[model samples]
Target: MTTSPALDGPLTTALVGTRRFFTRSQVSDDKRSIHTEGGRSGDAFYRDRWSHDKVVRSTHGVNCTGSCSWKVYVKDGIITWEAQQTDYPSTGADRPEYEPRGCPRGAAFSWYTYSPTRVRYPYVRGVLLEMFREAKAALGGDPVLAWASIVQDPDKARRYKSARGKGGLVRSSWDEVVEIIAAAHVYTVKRWGPDRIAGFSPIPAMSPVSYASGARFLELVGAPMLSFYDWYADLPNASPQMFGDQTDVPESGDWWDAGYLIMWGSNVPMTRTPDAHWMTEARYRGQKVVAVSPDYAENVKFADEWVAAAPGTDGALAMAMGHVILKEFFVDSQVDFFTQYNQQYTDLPFLVALEDAGDVADTAEGADGPAYRPGKYLVAGDLDIAQAASENAMWKPAVLDARTGDVAIPNGSIGFRYGDEGWGKWNLDLEDIDPVLTLHGLDAGGTASETARVVMPRFDAYDGKVAHVMRGVPVRRIGGRLVTTVLDLMLAQYGVARPGMPGTWPADYEDPSTPATPAWQEEITNVPAEQVVRLAREWAQNAIDTGGRGMILMGAGTNHWFHSDQIYRAMLVLTTITGC
Candidate 1:
């Protein structure tokens, strides 16, 4: 509020021809430099310029799972800048905090929002717009007739379709576009069916209001709503096949809990940028990381081991690992947890009929022989096992209860999922039924059938060497039907060389003679047999030590292949065997 006597003078020009004036506040002891007074004036300009009227929490529209919150600073009703919100709840004391959740894309969203090429309104193809305008003028402004006139002409339709993706889009009015869309939907319903009028508003998770609005309109019009989730080329078909869900992955937060992680074709740092930190943090906390890729991908930098596999041979590598896991964990040493998990959760205990459905091949008279080919699961209906009132007995699979040595009908088979369906019997309630995994020694009042050597069609390394691998399984007579446990067939199918188990089993991990062995996979995958063997052993051991804390993160690189389902199934089967 008051000035010193030294400042009682006109503001002296410190710098020539500039408004900046400064008084020598202090002289350095060296006398080479001097501290100035009026230098603080420029700080006020920056403080005013950076000042904002208000701040609001917002999210970027970049279609990521993070959904991070940002503090958008607004000045004069315009967004000035954004900052990542730091008030996220603590994950835990052990895990690294999830503050600063934004990425470069989220930070630069305001620039993209105001970019010149960004579409601010509805647009129509220029060629289509021309045809529509002409039709509209000729049809007396009836949008339906105008649209029909243009589409009904094959030349006009083809011309507009051909013009698409060539950057001829012109600005469109919301009213006109909405009218044209509604008219097109009406025309499509009338010409074809309501199913032809499909809607494709995407990413319901990020834009639920917009997605639901389009979905509601489509539903009202009886039009099909195309899914954005699981219909893409890279969609993981194996997830639904194995777990009955489109994506059966754990939450991103669970990455920290894994003791061993295999990045199978997933470039997490590039694809899942927001959650990539969790992987590094987990690694920091001594979790082992393995990267399986043909190229040195971005994720490989974070891995403790890198397996350079040949392209499209992921299934071979997976099956090789599965072979190793089955041999070491299940056969060589029967892990208690793995055995219990297989017995309780898997279909290994289910029985398979030796004969095709409704067809039983004749064998030598009274020789305890018959059925050549394996059919569907031998259900409860085939054994005259009574079900609860109003239950579908045919859908319930019959399992041999090891405790009672009696054929038991389980309560949670797919058949129990249907009939008398308010809630349906979907729970995994064994209800005192301890199913036998293998019927290798079971006898049902009659002589046991001789071992069945089933020939499985095998394709050798995608190299046109097609052959059949014979697997010998134990079969028995159950209720006058030749049958075998699924475990017996699977062991033989997986080429597990267990002692006393007859099959086309590999001699060892180094055996190239048998298929799905590590040495066999080396020819296809170009990955070292020793690496696969070591990874398998380590993965299973880690799962055993950590109570199944092993995880595999896979992505489009594997899922984009033609045989992606088989590849995923091989990987999943490896986990199933290791109980990971």
Candidate 2:
């Protein structure tokens, strides 16, 4: 038979035409599909891309929070595919194991290694390099002087500076880029001093070599090494403010141990994909899950209750919950665990000096007495304690002793640890003194009903106005000065209307005018008063029942506000009071 002209020529003879080698596959009787057998050979070529010579264990080196172990399959010398390693260490016998901890981004992360958009080499800004070259020629090839010439000129500086963020970079050699950086550093050090040449880099955990090298170089040059947390605004200011540490938080696996979990402003399912299962698994163990978000977030589906607060108004909702906790568990009736924990672990028992606001025009008197503002903590130096007049005595705070009902200076204060080595007790060991948490029952100089109404900072009040609350504060006249415990001032700050007190404590949770009432918080947080009340009760109950297994998983989402410290501090009050 005569072949078609399309496949007859010598030019076409070399080409592999499927028509000559194979017949058309028959269609199915139903006419919905076709069957082909020999064409499967082509799939082998595609499958060969996945055939690897070696498998290497590695991890993604970005600023990823999930530093998951990965098995990278390499063919010849190139990575072909990756798989999650299943050899993660067991958390505990009862807890869920941490295996296969990776996300989609991590799975496709290897593609970036060979992507066209990857920066495989150093690049210099086009305008900057042009200026550098011109300056180098004019300055007789002195790189430092050439860099100085460009930076010193206002017009030249503006030309390159304004070109930034417009993306006009050119390929550059590694040596040339290093030389340019050195020149810039030398010039900056000479002109503005080494203090001005601060260095900031990537997270050290991911890029330890680069981070350590840059840190060492900056340190040698007397330049301050800026922290990555403040640079990226992910400092979690509340941690340092509350705990005297920036990174003292519990690990993600700790979620399994939490009896009551609150996912506040953290989208665990979406962003933290690897750690999301800990929440679900914890729920299987009868753990209560609550989601605190403005919108219906991905994590809300997993929550038993969703507290939809107004955006950036979490501080208000938290303060309201704190009010409920302080009312029921602290002020109304003290839980034994809460009382013991607060007395031993927290600064609530530390005595504070009441500043005399004699000339202040805004000082208003409550129905019981004149309002006084809280001052610094009353230290050992302020009174004649056992350690009075000792070196660094000012740092040791005084507390009311439950055994003697006297102001006793504790030994584990900063004074004992810092200046004097003779004062060896640097731990929270109470030794013999039983520090009293609240002065409600224990009489001071006056009757148990007698209390101080104090003025403290209330950031979420009327148009950012300060709030004044009245509470029963048992005071002591020591060394011709009046002092009250931090617990009493904190109660006043939270607007917890104690028994037998007067002034602006909310009539009830329904009272809308008070600062921290659930109903008052409704106007700010848009969360229902009933929800806040219920959640607060449940949270406190959970903590009491489980011995402080209540946990809140907070992240950068909530810690990025203007007054993030205050916002976190507000929620932290709930856990602190509940001893969670």
Candidate 3:
């Protein structure tokens, strides 16, 4: 290529000495102009930023659940600022529109990236480095040998451990970090079991690739990747307890479809900053919001009513609410909402082996499954529930066969799907088949529970009864041990008083006038009986009117309880009845 007149000029003079833009084809300019405020033109201001040369698109790898994509502005290999990326592909017309997502804390994340406390390089405690070096010197510089020497001697290892907080960290090179880590793994795995040498990292949901890399390495080496859910108190055990599975929530956008919203415990705006606007927008769409919290939290402002029960008592409130809805709205109403939904979906229709588990005084203990194990829901098979389910998905829960006075295995449960065809293994429908929901003929039919072991297994029996007599599904018994429905068991489990009910086993605990009454719930939970009744009635009515369009949003505050299953079951009871 021929040289331009600009490049033909003396190189030094054209490049840096007042004359700018010394390219082969472009002219130079000082770019001086009083074109705007501060007597500076846009060109001059833009050109003055000498180091702003490149931008990289990336995201903060913080362990937050909602890690938004970011565009990182870089200059001289250092990040300057980051903004949310707005070009994600459209999911579909069926979903809500997307927006640039980020929280205030995440938006200010750059402060941490460039902070003084940020990690500059791999480091080991000063004392540990010196110990490793000395061991290396003595052990012929073999990394594995050096690590073994330090570890085999507990005193030497403890000496380095003691220096962790006291000794300043010594800068480490990449090679040294990798070598030391490899050697330590080799030594630990040799000395202890493979599972003993575990890998622990932060939430993988934020940055899956990083987690996968470490997990893959450990998995390849036969080392266990430690679970973080329970350790970090983040696992929602309630989901598994109620649904027999976990993680089945709809997207946040689904809130727009809900007509009644119960914002219980979760502060959506505070915790879900990116999606919080959707909730506010949902409110604009005429969704009624109820906030359940001990304090008047920020979200309370958006709520139509605030049920401020004391902390740690949210479970009681949920149970009380369930009681009111079950009795007043479900049982009393002609819709038969609770019973119909129970048959279609829930384990409420399944027979519960009501062979007197034991005298468990406390519902809290019952919830935890220590004081009383609510008898297993009975499954239909020639074999007992155990032997039948002994094979993969072999145990099938039986619904009462209203005809033939026998138990019929339904088409949708795990067992039936496995036994039937190969497709749709998890399908949950009762469409072509009608299964008996009540144990009314359990004994008379003589087709089921002819063997005592199927009706009442003695391995788990306790001294006293945990349910009232009416709670039992009035099935023929095996030598006097009666069968019951899970719905009945749940009623008794929640301290519902069944007073004046004749032959209600566990007579010591029943008060017919007290069970499920608003007064009882109000006493258990500090929430007023009148308010509880009102909310329950409204909740049921709204769901029924809208065909189950109500939504309940709960998070850590409710699910963190040790006996969280009770709260979950209560919510499940409500949701199931309304088909929500």
Clashes of each: 1, 1, 13
lDDT of residue 321 for candidate 3? 69
For candidate 3, lDDT tens digit of each residue in 1-580?
Answer: 2334555455644443433233223233432211222434556744543456676777665656665777776766766666788987875876455566777877778778779988889988887788888999998989999988887789998988887668588899999989999898887787786777767755677667877887788888888777655554433566677776765344677888898888876788887777777678788888889988889888888888998877766655676667766555533343655556667777766665644435432322212221223556566543344335433434666555555554555556666445334255456666555554444324444333322111111111135443322222234442233555565455454433232212222222122233455565455557887797788888888888887898888666665655555565566667766678
Please report how far candidate 2 places residue 198 from its true position, in Å. Answer: 2.8
lDDT of 1 at 282: 94
When 2 and 3 are scored with TM-score, the better candidate is 2
Model 1 spans > 4 angstroms off: 1-49, 135-157, 163-165, 234-237, 357-374, 388-390, 414-431, 441-449, 453-470, 497-515
Using TM-score, give the best candidate's number: 2
Residue range 395-489, candidate 1, lDDT tens digits: 77777888987788766667767656515457777779888877655555332336775555567735775556556677766777877888777
Better candidate number, 1 or 3, judged by lDDT: 1
* Model 2 per-residue lDDT tens digits across residues 496-572: 87665556676899998767889989998889999999999999999999999999887666766677667778877
Worst-scoring 10-residue span by lDDT in model 1: 357-366
RMSD of 2: 6.0
Ranking by TM-score: 2, 1, 3
